[model samples]
Target: MPSTILRRAACLLVVLAVLAALQACSSGDSKTGAAVLNPSTLSSTIPVTRAACTPFGAAPSVVQAALDGALNPSCEPGGEKLERWADSDGTMRDACLFEPAAASTAHPLPLLIYLHPSLVGTDLSLDVTNIRSQLETADLSGDPDRPGFIMLAPYGRVGTRYYPLPDQDYSPGWDNWYRQMLPDGQERRVNGTTYAANVDAAAIDHYLQLVLAQGKVDRRRIYIMGWSNGSAMATLYALNRPQIAAAAVYSSPDPFGAFNDPCVQQPVVGKPKDDTELQLLNPQLPIYHMHNACDIAGLCPNSLQLRDSLASAGATLIDDHIIDASLKDVAQCNALCGTDPLANYAGLDAPGGYAANLPGYAIGTVNHLRWPSSRTVDLFDFLRDHPKP
Candidate 1:
């Protein structure tokens, strides 16, 4: 084999190994939460259809190889298949697409655009939660014609240009205007770092266009969801594209420049700052947001700011909550709380993972990092009701 191919293969393997290790450590055991719902429990079923997708642009040999192993349209029935599309700039971007077995051209299904968490790429995102299967089962339980929806979970690029924290290395994550911008509208980063612009939104738009052209999607029911960093991306996308019917997110940070800092508890402005660049958010778009009460000190308060700002802006259908810490899954929280430095400050005492009982913070496990299996049905239930008006 050529040296270049050898080098590429080596690099890919290392990256995969690191990602696998991270998943093993962070995701915890599968049985930590509620049991996954069985599709057999539902009365409806979708017939499996063989699906196929073609690559739009030429990808590096490493990415192409991964795609070969991960995406096989000919055999996959109701599973996710990876595909690469060319950006306007001709760079290849990857996304894992999921189509239910019952999806047909005659009856279009809803389209779901899921943005993954930071450092968690497209592949790991699917495994992060059983929400995907729960959603599929929920869709199947409904009308037969619209048995399931097509999901597109796109991979984010790692770069200092988009998110530049001096203490953290660049990893896969979505771009956020509030997190990256300073009070004066300049990029927030170390002085010498090379700052770049946004391509994630454009890439997402391209992905949506590709799926829409397939004629198997119902444009009116398009919805988006995100976790952590991706939540900000989902919010920004819903704001920009009125075509999006609704948005659902978990533990999202403040996207309106209010309480953007994890260490700082105060808003950047005098009050909950909503008049930033994302102030143009449409008030009519339905938004469902849920935050963990024992999350990072700033995040739960940030959720409040997000909720209040949007509500004050005349957003009619907004649902926000700060789930009590006692209601969280102790096992899952125990697995995740150790990884976050702020977990102790939240007074999380989820067996083997907390210290210091801080007053005013919730007293229990830290449910901020992991997706509790208990809420999957509720989240999808909300998305199912509100289609674009």
Candidate 2:
């Protein structure tokens, strides 16, 4: 062949190789194709993974002690109190409240309200011992003052999930709602409401009001954190109440349709259910989401999309941590594994804790990476910077 013909052929081969390389990255490796996060100047993200070993060990006492240290001198760890408040019908609801030593009416403090997961075993209250244990390992506790913060973990009224509504469920709104049992044996209905009063939203609201009344709450710094289904509910609750400063969610998909908990619902009939509504209430609401590439729930994709949308709309901040576990695939990630579960595995290995060995992560397990991936970033530290205006 002529020299000109040879040059043209070589260029064609180079183009093909580049195209092939691009295809490989988009499959599931790179957060490029279908990525919901916007790389614009407004929003930013820094990916980080959990520690090398399981921070929460097999021993319950050890885990508790570790959590105690994480919260530090302001509050003694391992101790929890059950707070009971009146429901709409004048009945009582129970939740676990954690108070730092600095919590006093004279000096206001930030409040962190946590919602439990969708799955419920024998216990109906927040999995403080387990989930919060992870937070301890991550050192992701609140700090309103020098070394203190306020945390409230509320139990779910139906199916152990935060039923989305600003108040307790009444007859007309939940009048036509249906009822059924969630896979985890909790009773629930997604038609907005049912027999069970939705104190998840209402109860938390009432508690906030009570705290405000007590004059110990720094109203501008109030926030919420939830995992799995509860994470979705966090956004739902934020939609109704714009006063909430920020939200930190994990495992729940960013997009509205990642995982379907037909039972987890919005109790208010005419209330806003989509992003359009969320934007109207709080334009600069800061949200930090932990999404794993290995999630069995298929929540990462939508979560990324939502992150982008939020950034585009001028959100105060969107910390989208996309975890990538190359070896853990859809089937492998979703397997009935966990024989060697890591720190604070809640499903099968609980109360007693799990084997320190990992990779055989907990059921519905996704990427094990939690917390900000960068060595310099700390979630708890970042949270303190943003106080509501």
TM-scores of all models? 0.60, 0.50
**Candidate 1 lDDT tens digits, 247-366:** 888877655432212212111222223222222323466788777765643345556666666666555445876675654432222222222322223212232222333321333223
lDDT of 2: 0.43
Which regions of candidate 1 deviate over 4 angstroms? 1-82, 86-91, 140-145, 161-167, 178-197, 258-281, 326-366
**Could you give the C-alpha RMSD of every candidate to the true structure, in order shown?**
21.0, 21.2
Model 1 TM-score, all chains together: 0.60
What's the lDDT for residue 341 in model 1? Answer: 25
Instruction: For residues 302-389, write the lDDT of model 2, one tens digit per residue.
Output: 4555665555555545776655454322322222222111112223313232343233234224342232234213444555666665
Report the alpha-carbon TM-score of model 2 versus the true structure: 0.50
Q: Best-fitting candidate, measured by TM-score?
A: 1
